[model samples]
Target chain A: MRITIIGSGNVATHLAAAFKNGGHRIVQVYSREIQNAALLAYHVKAEAIDRLQDIDPETDLFVIAVKDDAIFSLGLSLAPYKKLTVHTSGATALTVLSSIMPNSGVLYPLQTLSKNKEVDFLNVPLCIEGPDEQTTRILEQLAQTISNKVYRINSAQRKVLHLAAVFACNFPNYLYEVARRLLDKQNIDFELIRPLILETAQKVQENLPVEVQTGPAVRNDENTMKMHLQMLQDEPGLQMIYELLSQGIIKNTKDGH
Target chain B: MRITIIGSGNVATHLAAAFKNGGHRIVQVYSREIQNAALLAYHVKAEAIDRLQDIDPETDLFVIAVKDDAIFSLGLSLAPYKKLTVHTSGATALTVLSSIMPNSGVLYPLQTLSKNKEVDFLNVPLCIEGPDEQTTRILEQLAQTISNKVYRINSAQRKVLHLAAVFACNFPNYLYEVARRLLDKQNIDFELIRPLILETAQKVQENLPVEVQTGPAVRNDENTMKMHLQMLQDEPGLQMIYELLSQGIIKNTKDGH
Candidate 1:
């Protein structure tokens, strides 16, 4: 299948490469900045185009892999082709494409993708959403070629998943930075806590996150909690984060499992 | 070397087993409940003693692996032994043991330990802090026997690490639970986000977490963030967490690197 990729960001680059590696032809890569598109295109062995009008007309599928805001305009531009069109966005709704194109869907890869780091595409969960049955099946088949884990998720579920991804990936990452900052204050190398972070994440792989939760909060170690809050006295933001999250853990743990 | 483990919780059990495997004899395992002590003792081929009075006189080292508040009282009880004593606590100061014993230190294993789950003891980072050089070296030597990674940390630094651990391990876990709850509302399985969690952690192993931070917060995707905040409107607590953490990421990212 001939695929044309729009945008040149991390998600776009990763998806484009995965598609190419899965035996699909990347007809052209599009970016507002032609050089950016060219860089990605060079890796996938595809043509690079600066304008949407220059997108390959011979493309079998056009993937609008741009930011959420850019997806509507890009989708509008590609609607004329009537080729199977999809956008790799978790937040954008299928309705954004449903009215414009008869064959429209979403191929949302639910993982943090970075262009510099290579991820095992097969392990990345692909959330596929489509305007209709055939389009959904097509996206799933396309996704399965590149990834082992693919689910036919609806627009609502995709949105929920995206929001959840923020908590699971983004927010936790922020917490890690907070941890780094805390250690930095004491001149302790952040590397010391790296193993603990890795093991914590690894635990959730086999066990439920809630079931395997451990901390001063869960254990109700008030003295330690008091000392921690005192340590963060100067920074009320961190103190609040510590208090709220600790309370949340205690409440959640006590509520049920 | 003969070691007696005080407290039969996760740390005590794991440490006792590790010490035994490292060619040190675990002379006794002590807990408030004899059954708990006996259970751990059975695993490590040691005697079970519930009372402090029954602490083996022949023990070379006494390891107190109880809760933070319990450390002082337990240390006081074992003060007469005057053996090279240590507590496996990140929060409690070494003074708790120093006043009680001539040779006191800390052998804090900085990984989340659960009795049900077997951890790779070799990968667990042992943070050792001793009152004197001699005691520090002894603990370091003992720590080296069970784990490949060991660090000489002072009380202040250990406390900082403990606080950091809350941010790195505990708080991130609560966020994971938040993600799970969000998915649960939509009847989606929590398993889907597990890979993202794992990869997020794996990324930090090679890259500074702040360097690899990715999300709407870092990307400054106002549109998606708005949608997310709206989605979480009913739950004000979660809404606040979303806003603050996102703001934190935005602020932190912009500050430096």
Candidate 2:
């Protein structure tokens, strides 16, 4: 399949390569910054364009793999390309593209894409939604070429999934930061928590996390919680997070019981 | 070393088996409940006792690996065996044990230990703290037998480390639960998020997490955040968490910039 990637960020760079690896043609790479566009286009053997007006209309799929805020503007820019266009975003609505393009859909790869790291697109769940059935089918087939798991998720469901991803991936990473800072304050190496973090994540593959929940908060050991709160007096923000989350967990446990 | 495990919890069971694997003899196991004691003792090749009066003073180290609240009481019960006691807790002060023993120390294995899952003590950080120089040296040597990394962390530092583990391990696991429930609401398999979660975690090892942070929250995409809040109106508690954490991340980013 012929493709035009409309972004030069991490998602666009990674996806362009993955598509190329999957035996698809990357015909063009677009970016507001000419250097970024040229960088990705160089790797994919494609044309680099700073302006969307320069986009080749002959491409089979136009992927608006830019930031959430830029999707609408990008769609408007690519309005002349009546070809199938999709954005690689979880939170943005499919209508954002359909509002401009005659043929539009979503080709959201449900994974955190980074330029430094090459992701296994085959494992990523590609969420596809479209303005019409034909475009949806084409987008679905396109996604299935790179990924084994494909889902027909509408805007509402996709938004929920995106929100859930925030809790699962983004919030947890912040929690890790908090942990690292706490340990660093006491001259403790953050590496010490690596094994524990990995094990905690691994447990979810085998068991329901609620069933496997352990620690002072879930157990409602008030004494340990009190001591931790006292220790965290210097970090009022973290203390607020700890207190709220613990109360939430305890309330959840009681409701379960 | 003739080790007597004075608890039948997850930490006690893992430590007893690890010691046994390291060719040390587990003399006995003690618990408030006889069944709990017997279950662990059977695995460690030791006798089980329900009463404190039944404790034999012949063991080299009487490990008070009980709950945080029970440590002081259990230590008081074994006060006669003064100079031969230790507790495996990062949060509790060594003085809690010293009040009941002439020699006492900490042998905190820095990992989240679960009863069902087996742990490789060799990789777990053993944070050892003792009252006197000789006792500290002996404890360090004992720790070296099970783990490659051993630190002489005082009570103040160990408590901080414990608090850090709560953020790293416990809080992340809780966030995972929140994600699972949110996905469940949309009839999306929570498993779809697994690869993303794994990749998010793997990224930290390769790059500085703050540099690699990408999400609607991290991007400060107010439009997406507002839409998510509207979608999550039914889940007020989760909504609050999402809003507050996003605010915190945005604040951090502003400061960073």
Score each candidate by Cα lDDT: 0.91, 0.84
Label model 2 with its docking quality class.
Answer: medium
lDDT (Cα, tens digit) per residue for candidate 1, span B8-29: 9989989998999899999999
What value does DockQ give for candidate 2? 0.67
Tens-digit lDDT string for candidate 2 (B33-148):
99999999999889999988898888898888888888998888788776478999877999998876788889998887788777678888889999889999999999888788
Candidate 2: tens digits of C-alpha lDDT, residues A173-219: 77877777777777777777777777777777776677667778987
DockQ, prediction 1 = 0.87
lDDT of 1 by residue, A1-257 (tens): 99999899999999998998899999899999999999999999999999776776898998888888988888888888889988889998998988788999889999999887889999999999887787788888889999999998999999999999999999998898899988998899989999999999999888888877888999989999999999999999999899989989989878987
Q: Which ranges of candidate 1 are over 4 A from the true structure?
A: none
The candidate that achieves the highest TM-score relative to the unseen native structure:
1
For model 1 the TM-score comes to 0.98
